[model samples]
Target: MKYAPELKRSATIALWLILLTFPIMVIQVNTIENIVVWRWMNIAGVGTVAFVLSFLWQIYQHRKTESPLPVSAHLPAFQRLLADPKLYRPMLIFIAAFALVFPFTASHYQINIMSTALIYIMLGLGLNIEVGLAGLLDLGYVAFYAVGAYSYALLNYHFGLGFWTLLPAGALLAAFFGILVGFPVLRLRGDYLAIVTLAFAEILRLVLENWNALSFGPSGISNIPRPGLFGIELTLEQSAVYMYFLLIALCLLTIFVIYRLQHSRIGRAWVALREDELACQAMGIDKTRAKLTAFALGATWAGMAGVLFAAKTTFINPASFTFMESAMILAIVVLGGMGSIVGVIIAALAIILLPEYLRVLGDYRMLLFGAALIGMMVFRPRGLITPSSRTYVFQPSEHQERT
Candidate 1:
């Protein structure tokens, strides 16, 4: 009797889902043959799945409310395992070994996919600094990415600059653009800031798309040349291997730098600003500098990743830097757990590689992916690994002890 209301609610939800999906799932039209096919079974299937999912969701919510355990007890098992050094250290070592050997053993196609995943990891971490640490929501991070790529393409086309030379140049140019965008949005926060950043990115993309002479228009620049190794020429396969190793090195460097920065004084300022802008300002932290630094530093990694992206693909196009790219990068950060270095890496790999591996399911792969994401959001809103709180221990100084 007590469960009757819950059951009714679930039924209602299932019915709604069936009604919503009826047109798409239950009916198929053949225009050439002038035929309409009805799959009534799809209605039953939708209802059953929706009912079961909704019922399970309600039960989970009920249990959560009734449970005697503290809120911390609900932390995800993966996060708990990560907190134990005994587990995570060995896991890290094993993963590192695998990553190093992966390029050698995996097929060239797989290596390329892994390289793309690494690039996203770089992008995720960079955005983490801005959105996760600084609480600045940037919807146009791909703009900086485009800047780095196009910088390499244009400079190489006209001035004959090499990858090694343009790598740092691309990053610097992106950082300069970051500062330029940051200056206008220093006072904006939340949605307003996101809008401004997104606008900036769109404007850049439009310029590149329209400026035929400068960017070569929609055709894009091709044969941009892969990264050279000490003036030595290499075959295509060898070049892929080199690019894979280069990405590994860059990802490591990015992780190290971000980890260090996360624990630094300026990093603390960013966190404080994120938590409370008014309070942070009251504490004498320079808000303008913090905001600008966050934007520039965060964009720096994207710029570097962009250079590598252009080199690996040996091409540059405005279409590649669309809003969807930004959304995916943002999804990596959010799904991984904001402000978590390890979480972002894990999320980036999973999000990028899962679809490739699930291609066996063909069209249904994305359906499964979408369902998984929905489940995650419903069950674990904080992400796979919640960022651990900073712990400080007090130790008496020698002078105080003497006194």
Candidate 2:
């Protein structure tokens, strides 16, 4: 029978990690002497960490599988608290309070990083609509983000329009492009659709990069102005704080709108489409409308995020919205648990903060990160926050008896 599968999985992971990280961890560049050096000790340390984590994961999995009850059942108090909405409501409130007060306690560096994470959170929420809700694989969702950034940058530079005014303009323009891009791919599905969308993004990026006359080319458009609060220009720290709050508002708006849409009739239709296109068509749902709407709405949010990103950095460049960026956004969605808001937020924070915290590792940071991600996928394929919702059951007998 199958037993200790985790051990087999961990062994595979350890082997891969050694192969991937050996060269980086074992070899070092001694810039002072201009010579290449080998650090066997460092390699051993890195390998040990990877192997230990994998082995521990196996133990955790064994315990989890052996337990017949839910994972949270061991913590009776926590389970009871979660079961009671009244108790959890206060906890949620406390969490929100802490978030509101977080910047005050943290450094400017931390605040800035958090703001970046929030932007990705918005992007992840948008992409979730297509990949998670509608099951549309889009590898070039960053096109809309670039569109939004350029739209805002060009409009502001040419017309002297402020960021507040440019926000909706960017989203609308992105949504327009979304529809334009969505039309051609409506007939395509799966990998074909993904390829087409990806091509579309590359085309847009190339246009922006080469058309220096309009986009300022590879040099990028700089000196982009930041939004002010109450017509007052703030210091760098104040600006960072203001941007942080702005992101908070935008993130909440995204969450609320997506939450509403997820529970609405349109959401139900999208879910049907995702489950089985043939079955969805047989149920009388209009595939065209559902698909287009998903694209439009998802792109709209990405555009908004792009606008925020431009404003935050005060620069717009094609390099900022590359295929790597798209991959990162997709990774956040997948790692966060598709169709889960809280999961997306948590994943975004982890993706952003983990790298920052790993700065001490220097060149070895990404190696460890990739290994951790692999481990996460192996151990918790469903993601840290799995997609879950409450269900209501109706009893016809009870209704008749009551009547």
Candidate 3:
């Protein structure tokens, strides 16, 4: 499945150029009934949309001639994608560039976007561990996030603990809650499973709201401290930039850990359990341990993200950790392509960054975002970056293969 170098380069360049131009197309003009903004060039967003439509039309016109098979009129887009590594390589490069350049860009508004995007990326990774790798559908991921944030705030403000110390403790608390959630519905499956997970997440949220004496109830925690490296506080000039690097490092580390685990015995066990718990159990893989491990590990990431969130914003609220937040994180895992780290990262960025870019589009913004997501899902059901052989190859068994 190889493509010529010239075509590959062209594909990659075009894709990124479109992507890069996309964010700059529309700017928030004003907000009356709806948020509106100024456009960069002449009718910017509209022009961009027209260009994309024209491009798609050209590709469609080539259908039978350049694309294969009767059923493949629509398939060439994806096939061409898989055959060319160039299409997504620029994306990788762009992400790397952004990681290096964005923090240096002196705009508080832009920095806020970067921080939020990083937080969502962390959240997406957490969901990916549960749903993508272990095949567990978590509808209330934000519960763990809430737990982590509150844990740190309560522990630190009340007990006078430091950020470095409470960070791991936050994650551990989230994992403990994950285990609690996992245990109750250990026998549930499919819709039942989803319902239970949702229930668990809501239960936690409700508890936070009602229990005001200790948890601060609905008032939420304010003035949470920013974490400092050694004695160097991040509150100095360019604090966002400092936090940016820290987050990037943490995210990369998390990604590295996930990659290692995905290739390790525990990771394999998760996939096995995902595919068939009964069979996995018969093989003595211990379904209970594997399931709990998946829940715990996933929640740990959520907790860690909470710690970062508390530090950066220096404010906390129950609204931030709603079920909708969980849904958005799960959306990243699904929209990006499950079990594909690269894809998940893209999805996370898109979910967070796209809306900010479309602020100028105002009234039509959400409508357009929803349409684009639906359109992409319809076109690339497997996700923008489908799992390839090199990405995640299932472990084999000779007996099963023979059968």
The TM-scores, one per candidate, come to 0.92, 0.86, 0.76
Give the Å error, residue 376, model 3. Answer: 2.4
> How many residue-pair clashes does candidate 3 contain?
6
Residue-by-residue lDDT tens digits, candidate 2, 266-300: 99899889889999999999999999999999999
Please report the candidate that would top TM-score against the real structure. 1
lDDT of 3 at 206: 84
Residue-wise C-alpha lDDT for candidate 1, range 122-190, written one tens digit per residue: 999999999999999999999999988988888888999999899999999999989999999998879
| Candidate number with the higher lDDT (2 or 3) | 2
Write one digit per residue (lDDT tens) for candidate 3, span 259-371.
89887889888888888888998998988888899999999999999988988888887878788888889889998888878788888999989988999999988888888
Compute the lDDT for candidate 2: 0.89
**Order of models, best lDDT first:** 1, 2, 3
Stretches of candidate 3 exceeding 4 Å from the true structure:
1-66, 69-97, 233-237, 389-403
For the record, the alpha-carbon RMSD of candidate 3 to the native fold, in angstroms, is 9.9
Name the candidate that leads on lDDT. Answer: 1
lDDT of 1 at 15: 99
